[model samples]
Target chain A: MASSYSIILAILAAAAAGLVGAFALMKRTILAGDVMSHIAIPGLGLALLFAWDPLVGGGLTLFLGILIIWQLQKKTELSAEAAIGVIFASSVALGALLIHSDEALVDALFGGFKNLTPAEFAFGAGASILIIVALWLLRNKLIISLFSPELAISSGINVDRINLWYLLLFGLAILANLRFLGALLVGSLIIIPAAVSRQLTHSLGTFLTTSVIVSVLSMLIGTFIAMHYNLDTGATVVVTAAAFFVLSLFKKKR
Target chain B: MQPALTVLNIEVSFDGKNVLEDVSMELGAGESLAVIGPNGAGKTVFLRALLGMIPYRGTITWAPKTRIGYVPQKIDADRHLPVNFKNLFAAKASILKLPAADIEEVIEIVGLNNNIITTSVGHLSGGEFQRGLIAFALLGKPSVLIFDEPTASIDVAGEEQIYDLIHRLQDAQGITTIVVSHDLSFVYQYATKVLCLNRAGVCFGEPDIALTPEALEKLYGPHKYFHYFNDSHSDDHRTKNHDIQQ
Candidate 1:
């Protein structure tokens, strides 16, 4: 059995990753986050290729993903959605090719959840706290930017700077959650909670608060279920979060 | 005191077709200017250009430090989207960081009660939505307010209320107001200046001097049915005046 400290550490890591994902979804930039998550795959392959840690590889991969997406969005005629789609498809293909040639595909796909060292836990927890605090301080500006960027500009809010910060924080969150949730499900964790919360509240503050609560609860419950049933933790967490989303929809309908 | 706004050598074209050319006009502050012309006379384009929503090649400058507010001819907001007055007001204030009380003050000035604050904009009658737009524009306490055919989709009663609201806002705030309208009778009652436009701006002055029959004939030509109707109405009044004098 995993130590009590380890379980707590895992829950904390999941919550942090979930919160970052939630923030991205709230801002309606989930496509960007999804692209960054996929780009981490090639990084995982390269990390395994060099006998380096996958988390480090994943972080570097996610950073490159962000750079490609940002540059394409600014420079290309393609809309933000199309840019993300192109990057996402290409990154996934490249990652698949790298995995086929260098590392066992199962290892990359299942991720390194069983090998969560105490050091990685600490790193994830620290990164998550930093991202959450940054989002909190800029919540007001972020909401305004999301709703109407032109109005935000006239009001003296530097929208470009805020979008840059959001991208940076999103990259870091995807990087931190790579080991615990794998790169594939990390995007879902970010999107599902916030989307569920959106149906429950109209106020921005309420939506964010409820998103955090739902994320934390899903992590804890999913972790417990995984432990009892001896199931894969990452899959179990996402499934549980999905369950919560479905529950929110029903409750909202009532 | 040099007219509130000056538009000189303004030219706007869409896809190589000229919408307006060499359109020029000057309006004074605390004065009401009514722009009247047939359809496709670039009335909406002129208003949008003033708001900086479209790109135009010419010099159009307002009086120094003039805060300008605009109400579009129509807001094509999606009916499916659940937008309400509070949501709309909050969306704007979410940028300015203005307190709730400030939003409420503008809503009250527009004569919209608390019911409008919570009701969905999709469900509001055209009159209510127009008032909401006016309230949204006025929330900034602009020095100049421009309305582009605000009463186009509303009933006569709604138009009267809108006109009254416009006058009320002008009187209360001393704002320089410009309205683009086809309602000549309404303009006669409220406007201090008139700007007549076609593919090019034709005249800009007091309505009595600017809206001469000759000028109307030149701008509208065969489309002077409404102008003649107004002329006959005025002739009847003149005849009655002569009879009274006798």
Candidate 2:
């Protein structure tokens, strides 16, 4: 039996993921974002080992991963995908070695929908709202910067600073959903909905809106299916989102 | 009156290798300056330095209140991107906190119609896309227009139209123009001054006076100079001098 609070939080997080995913897809960083989530695995494993709050540990390492990726790109002049790929492989290995218990590892890898306490709901919902609002405010800058960094620089926008902000917000979005979606599949929610929406829409506004709709639909449907069949919520939600993407491929892009 | 721009002994390097060295030039207000060079001659790098997009050693100065509008050579945009010209214009306008009327004015100036503005950027033709970029640069009413090969992607006929449009914009607005061009004819037609670069300032002055046969030969290796002029003009001797004022 899923609590209404848990469902509400999940829905809000889905909307946030949808918005973030739209920008990620447009920036061609969707795959990089998937790998970015893996950096949180080692943190989750450490928290389990030490009996600390798992989300707190995940948040710290995710923040470190974000900074490392940003600095790697800046210093090495490597593309974001390449920089993230380097960090992702090491973080996954470290996480695998740290988590000694199989059951805890499964719980960390494929998240379950547990009853949400008021504090957890408040924190998760607050993070979701923060991501959504920050993205909305930064959308115009992000649009121009992603289109052309040279043009954005000439237009008086601080492109590097904007990129850093985007990376931070992207990490926050992942952290907000890490408890429910887990590291393995959380990035899929952020990648698949926007992909589906991209196939269907041809304008920025439509693309963002449709992505949010698809993400929310996936969350709701996946939750129901999970509760009914006693299946994993995170895996089911990601699969549902992937299903939407496959169906969207059938619609001829105009 | 003060000069519109001045670059003094500018030097840019990457990985300890100097891409541009001892490059210097000046442009007066309402003047059109053409930067000519062979491939990898640091022409684009010079433009980036001028725009303050990259760091360089020497001083590059623009007069106070000098707002620059830049049209880059090419945009490697994703073809399936959902953004249209209108969306890009609106985004720039919003970032600059400009009024909607400003967008309409630029659209009219660049001769972009509603259909073109509504179409996705990747879908627009080469000429239409170039016009859209020019229109984007026109926003915020910049005092200087900097173009990096404005017609690189355009066809032969479209190149002429783009040049004419740039020439017209200069005449109508009296804005300072700095263009990096490969077309010798364009330099003679529109530029008030020309700076020939080959890792350094090889020559700087009016087209006919500074671009001597010897200078052209030095800037573009002798073989390339002969081939370029011979392919375009009828006589080799006349091509050497290239009396473009005709």
Candidate 3:
């Protein structure tokens, strides 16, 4: 069950990381994604206490965080980053207070994928697959919105509605990846793969393809390494992604 | 014929700082209107208000079933964005449901090489990039086209070529064009009507009469030079030049 869950997670993580990651990176919402995941830590702690699926808690909390950030920024003139900063500070302070137990803290931060039940596995698989398909189907409009929002509006795309929908899906994708990448590093898993792929290709198709391939390969390799050496799963996976980013930064001869 | 677009009592304020105030204009079908202003004179604000992109207290009435094609002041894109003409064309085809023949016609009209469709947008030269963007806007098959600083990056010869192409396109297709530019020379050559936009609407009328020294002084705070068509012919001939006096 454990290995099967890891396999499912690795596959879904690849697709979600590549697809959602591209949107996150392009929209300049990488920081917001990272900060939202961090804000989910306390939710995970509460979920553990209640013996609930931690992803549920994390997803709910992340959604709430998005609303708080959006409203605060909308009602006031606070920049999105500044709004996220304020919420993030309060979130971390609350997370630190709630996550008193060491095991819960480790699980929240490092993500233990070794004990996922069949039900949890199915939930993760379902959510991740849904996100992947949604992204694939919405690529054209999403690309338009990301590239030139004014064009999107002029072309009759509801830019605001699309933005809100994308944000909600981002929260869900982060939740789905929380099994292995953990709340602390899930956003990085998404960002690193897409960032590396961006440096490699000049065509959108090639960029997306490279992102997915690199992410899948990294997840599988990191899983193997963690299993063999008894290392931290989340940290090892993120390190593998970072390695890909480093490799992509090398200049090829013109 | 009734004007294709009408703006009444238009005003835009950002954080209580007035960007545009009590501005109004009427654009007729098949007419080319140039919006000329100095930098920071709310020309962009005026354009965005027309596009319905910003909040403004105004009534912008468009003729029934008027489809507008918009080209923004600047395309906010990163140097590394993975965009090729083919991809952009494909996206346009999907969104606008344009036929292949119509799309190819637009590509030809914009004077872009058919073979350049495979090249990435970032790699295209400044002139080529402008042509490509114009091609993209043409895909909408709009009755009206709005351009913001379309010649900002092009060289002098490239600018002439673009304005010539625009004039030819307008003549061929009878599309209403609203252009925002600081190039008084090009605007004078191409514009049938002109509006000098400042915080408050400075002046609006035919190009020859609207671009008078008084309006120029008010909009630009005493310009060095300006040229207009000689009053004898009432035609677009850039032969006459004059200096603004205090």
Candidate 4:
């Protein structure tokens, strides 16, 4: 059975994921975000080894990874996927090497249903709210940059700084859910809902709203089903989101 | 005709290889300058350099308070993207803190209707998309407009319309226009000055004077098209390639 705090944190995280995913899908960075989630694995491993707070450790490495990827993208002019590729492989390998226990490894890969303490819940909720608010404020700039970076620059918007802020927000979104969805499955929560929303809508305003709604619904229903069936919560959530995507395919967008 | 832009011996290089070297040009206020060259002739590079999108080793002076609006050759917009021109315009408007009236004004100036602007970008026709880009560039009341191949993807008839729109915008708004174009006829007709580029400044002056057969051959290499410009042109060849002759 899931605790109330876990459910609340999961819902908040899902909302953030939905918002982030909408932009990531448009920016064509959804897949890169998947790989970005894995960058946290090494940090989780180090935390587990040192008996440190896993979220903190994961966040440190996730942000470091984001900064490195941002710099690589700026300096090397590689696409986000190419830059994420440079970091993804090594991070996963290091994580695998450091995480000695198989159970710990499994938990890190596909999250464990651990009851959250009041502090953990607070931290998670704060991060989720920050992601939502920041993305809301940045949405207009994000839209322009995703549409055309050159146009954004010509508009006097700093494309690089906006990109950095987005990447950081993307990292923050991943970090907030790293405990709930794990490194392997969390990206799907972000990607699938937005994808489903895209399939159903043809306008930005509705697309964003639909994605958040689908994401929250998936999290709530997935939690209920997982608790009832005694199934893995993260997997159940992802599978639920995937089911939405499958259904969206039937309603062909005009 | 006070100079709106003055460039002196600009050079741009990437990875130790020079893409543009010793290129120079000048543009008077309200002048339509056409930049023409064969593919990979640093035409886009020159534009980027002027726009300050890339670092260059020269002085480029734009008259103070000169705002530039750019229309790129193409944007590989994702088909599934749920953004329309309205969303895009709103986004830009919000970013620049421009009033909504400015958006309405640009939409009217570009002749884009509410229906077309509201349609998803992926669903828009090539002409519609081009018009949307023009409207986008027209935002913020830019004093200068730079276009990279404004009609590269449009059909022939659409191309003519796009050229007409650009020419009209220039004339009506008195916006200093710098266009990278492949259509020599449009260049000859509309360009107040022409810059023929090929990794260097091959020629620069009025289109009729600077765009001689010798100058064009130097810029694009020897082609049968150059024969059309020669005073001793053959009627047979002109009839054969009437489009190029034009």
Native contact recovery (fnat) for each candidate is 0.06, 0.74, 0.58, 0.80
Per residue, candidate 3 scores C-alpha lDDT tens digits across B1-246 of 789999998999998988899888898999999997776889988888888889999799988889888877556666566776667767877877777787788789988876677776666666677777788788878888888877666666676877887787778999999998767777778899898887889999898888788888888676433432222122222211211011
Misplaced by over 4 Å in model 4 are A75-83, B227-246
lDDT (Cα, tens digit) per residue for candidate 1, span A4-117: 655666666566666676567655567777778888888887887798877788788787777776666554355767767887888778778777643355556544356567
Which window of ten consecutive residues has the lowest lDDT sum in model 2 chain A?
A: A72-81
Query: What is the alpha-carbon lDDT for the whole of candidate 4?
Result: 0.86
lDDT of 1: 0.73
Model 1 misplacement above 4 A: A1-33, A46-83, A100-127, A130-169, A252-254, B12-21, B33-48, B53-55, B70-101, B113-115, B118-133, B146-159, B178-246
Query: Tens digits of per-residue lDDT for model 3 on A21-71?
Result: 877777666777778778788788778777877877787788888776555
Highest lDDT model number = 2
- Taking every candidate in turn, the Cα RMSD to the unseen true structure, in Å, is 8.7, 5.0, 5.6, 4.8
B1-246: candidate 1 lDDT, tens digit per residue: 577898888999988999998888777789888887777899988887887666899999988888777776654443322336676677667656678888989988888987866765556777887888788777667899889887776766777899999987777788989898877886788899888889788877888888877778877786574664465233222222011010
Give one digit per residue, the lDDT tens place, for model 2 in A46-106.
8998898888888889888888776665653556556577788888889989999988888
lDDT of each: 0.73, 0.86, 0.77, 0.86
Chain B TM-scores per candidate, in order, are 0.89, 0.92, 0.89, 0.90
Better of 1 and 2 by lDDT: 2
Worst 10 residues of 1 chain A by lDDT: A147-156
Question: Ten consecutive residues with minimal summed lDDT in candidate 4 chain B?
Answer: B237-246
Poorest 10 consecutive residues of model 3 chain A by lDDT? A69-78
List residue ranges in candidate 3 displaced over 4 A: A69-78, A251-254, B223-246
Give lDDT tens digits, candidate 2, residues B47-142.
Answer: 999999888999998999999999998776677788888988999999999999999999999899999999877777778988999999999999
Instruction: Compute DockQ for each candidate against the true complex.
Output: 0.13, 0.70, 0.56, 0.70
| Tens-digit lDDT string for candidate 4 (B1-246) | 459999999999998999999888899999999998877999999999988899999899999999999998777667667899999999888888999999999999888999999988877777788889999999998899999987776666777888898899889989999999877887888999999889999999999899888888888678844543442112212122111110
